[model samples]
Target: MCIPPEAQWKRATIPDRRSVPFFGQGRGLTDSQSLDSIPPPPSPKLRRAQKVAEQKAQRIQDFKQRCGPGFSSSSAWQARPWQHRIAIEQGIRKQDALPEEMEVVEDPTIEEPVGINPVQVEVGEFEEPTVDVEEIVAENPCQNYHCKHGKVCELDENNTPMCVCQDPSSCPASTAVFEKVCGTDNKTYDTSCHFFATKCTLEGTKKGHKLHLDYIGPCKFIPECLDTELSEFPLRMRDWLKNVLVTLYERDEDNNLLTEKQKLRVKKIHENEKRLEAGDHTVELLTRDFEKNYNMYIFPVHWQFGQLDQHPVDGYLSHTELAPLRAPLIPMEHCTTRFFETCDLDNDKYIALEEWGNCFGIKEKDIDKDLVI
Candidate 1:
């Protein structure tokens, strides 16, 4: 019935929870000790190497699967295992060895390793290599060439780039027949491309130089332009030019067809209350309006000439340069050919600025080179 002192003392000293071990103790350890006991995570270099090895192994397995059992019997595949082993050993040595421990020696007596053949060399045994300039030029000679207008460069049998007539089919398709044109020979072409291509085909002949784009639309019975009509041409043309610039200014709110410089010059004509609007006008109306607003017509006429004289800018309008304006007008305006023919005062095949102004009735004293803009 009496409790022993030793048992009472033992009960009092004993704890209710389990005991945690001290550092470096058996069975139970501290957090730091536990972390230290665990193996350190692999180094970044080692992890990367392992990943690469795994990828290589996977690729090899995939190749084997695709090639089947017969693949292993092939010479390349048979030699692969040895190659892989050698590669792995070399990689390990590279990673583990110090820079000083690595040595490279030229062994002339040793047999050449697999997949490598040695080239024997002796002093002053070199020969100068011959180069074929023609072969080099043949590779892409067309890249250095530029063909004339309406023509194209083509490679011949000798791989030389030569100017040739462009295929008519290569020209863009016309959306409407209204885009068709008539040549001087009274033949109707599908588009300007057909006409130019035909001209290019006749390059060396006298007929080629004579051939010209006559008019817009198609061939029709064009009455001969009389001298009286030629005299009246400038009056109508000046009025038309002024009206064109004014109309362009009015519609140019959203469309930026006119440059800032062009718009500034056109603004004066746009605001002129007395200026005649575009329409079918009599020669009397054209001449009277031009006289009333002569200054307004001058700039637009000069501007048009400048725009057309772009290809060679030598103050002369070439046939190609005049095509845009002249071709379209010839069919509609009966006086077009005669007016232009008269503009070439010297019959030099080019329309000089002075001659152009004279054709438009600009006074000799008022004709200025600065107004070409």
Candidate 2:
């Protein structure tokens, strides 16, 4: 994800593809708290402990719902209570939690002294454990440093962490050919690590500047794009894009995958009686629908460009910026490479917003910036 130290910041801004979607970013709270059960006996300490555990569990569940999907609030209280961390970890954000309270459910037979107040016991009886921050760092200084892909963090003589290119041989070997990748130099490498490490070695040279990952698989012959095929490429692509969005809208009952503007745009396509549903349709049908519903495809075309143009939010797209979309699409859509190459009409090594729209058959006058949102 980076070329060198100078380029590390750029790739750091790109979100990791592995993250689950976060919904209601600004919403402060979720209404996930459930009605609590009362303790069998009337000791206030037991009652308060039950109350504390219920509140903690409710907050944990709310966090799950905020992060979204596969996390629900109906589970029983945890077997153990939250442990108090005397010193917060370097990069971890702190969350609200009671310190080292034993689970009331796990130790049901025990009882707190009837006359003692739990609040005073928690505050006055307990003291924060003294920990040396330096000892933690001394154990593993490299753990806190952020290293880009193809690089590893290492401790120097002074024990300061720094990024260095990783050895390709250290990368795990796989027997499958699918693990292989081809670089822009047309040389096939064993894996992504091998490819990127090779690139990292080339650092600040002209060849390094020129070299990039070509595609996901081993290099092979890609047929040249004929005039007719290039023209028809957008027909299937636009229809496919529109149907994808519509499908997301229909299934997005709880996903919140589409934004407000995107939902509004896709609603038109979802409700249109003439709109094409996703399936393997003949080329003639694809072309016919493109002609009939030309307006529907325009926003999808521009929206895709905006999605990929996010590293620096510039009007142009570099090869690195296009990798998220391009790498996955290339194997299925062979024309993908030639289509994009031809899109850069001025041969500036970057595709501007106008060139992208033109490639998808949007008229120059109809390519509105408002549609990109």
Error of 2 at 19 (Å): 99
Which lDDT values do the candidates have, in the order given? 0.71, 0.69
What residue pairs are clashing in model 2? none
Model 1 clash pairs are none
**Tens digit per residue, CA lDDT, model 2, 1-373:** 2122212311332233111111122222122432243333344433543554455555555566565656443332221111111111210222222143455776456556546655324445767888767644336777778886678998888978889988888888857988888787989899988888878878889998888887888888766767787777888888878877788889998757888888988888788899887888888999888889888888888888888887778888988888877776677777888888998999999999899998888899989877777
Per-residue C-alpha lDDT of model 1 across residues 32-108, encoded as one tens digit per residue: 33223434335554454444434445555566566665544234433444543343344445444424334677767
Q: Model 2 — TM-score against the truth? A: 0.58
Residue 62, model 1, lDDT: 62
Best by lDDT: 1
Model 1 lDDT at residue 146: 86
- Mark the regions of model 2 whose C-alpha exceeds 4 Å error after superposition: 1-148, 153-162
TM-scores for the candidates = 0.58, 0.58
